[model samples]
Structures are given as structure tokens and as C-alpha cells.
Target: MPHTLFIADLHLSAGRPDITAAFLRFMAEEAPKADALYVLGDLFEFSIGDDEQSPLNRRVASAFRDCGVPVFFIHGNRDFMVGRRFAREAGLTLLPEHQVIDLYGEPTLIMHGDTLCTDDAGYQRYRRITRLGWLQWLFLRLPLKKRLGIADGIRGKSAEAKQDKSITIMDVNQGEVARQMRKAGVRRLIHGHTHRPAIHRFDLHGQPVQRIVLGDWYTQGSVLVVTPETETLQGLSLGENR
Candidate 1:
């Protein structure tokens, strides 16, 4: 039975050796078994630019190259700077912010899910600025040291902002999610960003729809497996590695 795997919010960095070890294990032991793999976003804690080619990034790229499956990556809020260079090195196909595809014969919409957090006006404004072509080009031209400093500053501010924000504002907005689903003409939506993993079934314009949220890999690994007849969310425990 052919099946597809979806994951997101790994936020992989050099500091988290435990998570990194788990991810390497996953690529070697689990991902190769899937027909295709979709990484919705935040694959890294922060990607200053593709040119850095840090040791950690190189390791991840090598792992992806050896995964033995078609891998696709969507830019997340944290790692939106992941460009073509990185994708090519990692042997991954880069996807747009929102992509609609036929999944086992069903129309499915996949995204990084940040755009759906409309209630967080501040974050949305930041997203708009960072996504601008001119601004991104200018940012990328800075020296590697400067780029890293800026990323660290921005990350610090983001951390502080989250402390002041309510959970509801950080999560996806229902209306925005529905609007995106309608635009994509999909009854099933798969996304990651909020880091809250759950299956949501609702009625949209009298039609039944479902939304699946993928969790972060901060504490454990979360994955969604979809086949012709079934869709399931499974968590891989870090304790198992002990």
C-alpha cells in the first residue's frame, strides 16, 4: 500500500542534538518507506541564507539526499529564506506557500499555515515585509555575520512577542482557513505552523470539510500518514531512543 508522509516545525538547529538524532533516525528508518514526503515548514530554527551552508545544514541536506523518497518543502515563517540553492543541495522540490494537489484521488490543500493566522496582525505585517522580493534580495546581500546577527535579533523579538500574545491569536483564524479551503476547492486541508496537532472536521457552506494540523518536533516527532483508505497521525517518542 502506497502512502504519503507529512511533517513540519522540526526547527532543527545545532543546539538540539536529541531532536537532530531523532530526525536522522527518522530519515534512515521511516521516511524511505513512504511513497512521498511533504515538509510543510519550519524545517530549521532559522535559515539566514542558503549560502551559509553550515555544518548542520549540510548534514540535513545529506540526510535528505539519502532518504530514497520524493521530498517536497514549503517555506515556513521561520525558514522562509530557504532558497533554490538549499533545495537543490538537499534534493527537495520547493513548493509555494499554498499548494493544492490530488491526494490519493482527493483534492487536498497543503500549506505552512502562517497565512491563516490572520488574527496576529503584527506577525502578518512582518510576513508581508519579509516576503517582498526587493527586501529579501537586499537582506540576502548582507555579509553572513550581519545576516546572522539580524536573524538572532528578530528571533529574540519574536520570542518576547509570543509571551504577550494570547494562544488564540497565535493559532489559525477559522474564517481565513475556510476562505483558503474554498479558494483551493478542497474539502481537506493539511498544514503546519500553529504546532497544535489535531483533526478538525467542520461544515463549510453545507459541505463537510476536514483540517489536519501537524505538530512541532520540540519534544517529540509528529507525522501524518495518508493512504487510499486511511489517514492517521502518529507520534514518535524520543524516549524510545534511550
Candidate 2:
């Protein structure tokens, strides 16, 4: 069967070499067998810049280059800084924040999923400001060391803020989700960010619709497998599916 793969929130970094290794292993094994690979978002915990020359960054790019599959990446809140240079080097196709794709005949809306969390007023406000193109350009123009330091401060504050936010506030809002679906005219939505993985089935104006949330890579490798006949989310132990 021809199947496509979707993943998100791996948050890969030097500190998490185990996760990186697991992901690389997957790219070498499962990814090459897929029709294509879609990295929905947050491939990194925090991406400083495309100009970064870390071994961790290079290794990941190399894996994708060798995967033998067309790779697609959507900018996530954590890795919104991933630019064209890195995409070219990694042989990745960069996708917009909100994208609609034909998934084996289904019109699916794909996102990094942060925009669906309308309840998080603070994060939404921060998102709007930080994503300004000119602002990002200015920030990236700074020395890599400085950019990393600023990213650390921001990530630290984001972590602390999450500690204070209720689970409901951090998760996607049902109304916003419906609105997005309506706007996109899509009955199926797939995304990852909240680290909560599940299939949500609901009715949209008396019609059936589904939302698929991808899992984080903190514990197991999370993947959403889609084929002409089925859509399933699976968690993988480094080398095998469990």
C-alpha cells in the first residue's frame, strides 16, 4: 500500500541525542519506505538559525538527504526560524504555517497546531510579534551566540508560563478548530504541538469531521500513517513499533 507519514514535535537537540538517534534510525528504516514524509512542526526544541553549524543540525540534515523520500517541513513555534538555506541543504520542501494537501483523496488541513490554541492569549500575542518577518530578519542578523542566548531566555519563560497554564488553556479550542476547518473547507485536520496524541471525531454542520493530533517525541517516536484506506497514529520504540 502507498502510505504517507506525518510527525511533529520531536524537539530534537544535542541534549537529546537518544531522540535524535531514534529519529535518524527511523529515517534510515521506515522513512525510505514511505511515499513521503511530512514533519508537521517543532523539529527542534528551539531553532536559533539556519546558519548554525552544530553537529546535531548537520547530522539531521544528512539523514533527511539520504532518506530517499521527499521531505516536507512546516514551521512550528519552536522552529519557526528554519529558513530556506537549511531547507535546501536538507532537501526539504518548506510549507506554510497553514497548508491544505490531498492526502490520498481526503482534503486535509495541516498545521503546526499552535494557532488552534486560542485559549492561550499570552502565547498568541507572542506568536504574532515574534513571527514578523522584519523582526525575524533583524534577530537572525545578530551573532549566533546572541541569538541562542535570547532563544534560551524565551524558552525558559515559555516553559514557566506553561507551568502556570491550565491544560484546557494550553490545548486547542473546539470553536477555533471548527472555524479553521470551515475556512479551509477540510473535514480532516492533522497537526502536532500539544504533545497529546488522539483522533477526535466530531460533526461539522451535521457532517462528520476528524482531527488527528500527533504526539511528541519525548517518550516514543510518534507518527501518523495515512493511506488511501486508513489513517492511524502509532508510537514507536526506537527500532520497532510497539
Cα lDDT, all candidates: 0.94, 0.94
CA deviation > 4 Å runs, candidate 1: 239-242
Write out the backbone clash pairs for model 1: none
lDDT tens per residue, model 2, 155-183: 89988998999999999999999999999
Off by over 4 Å in 2: 239-242
Per-residue lDDT tens digits for candidate 1, residues 1-242, read 89999999999988787788888898999999999999999999999999988888998999999999999999999999999999999999999899998999999999999999999999999999999999999999999999999999999999999999999999999999989999999999999999999999999999999999999998899999999988899998765432
lDDT (C-alpha) at residue 215 in model 1: 94
Candidate 1, residue 121: Cα displacement in angstroms equals 0.5
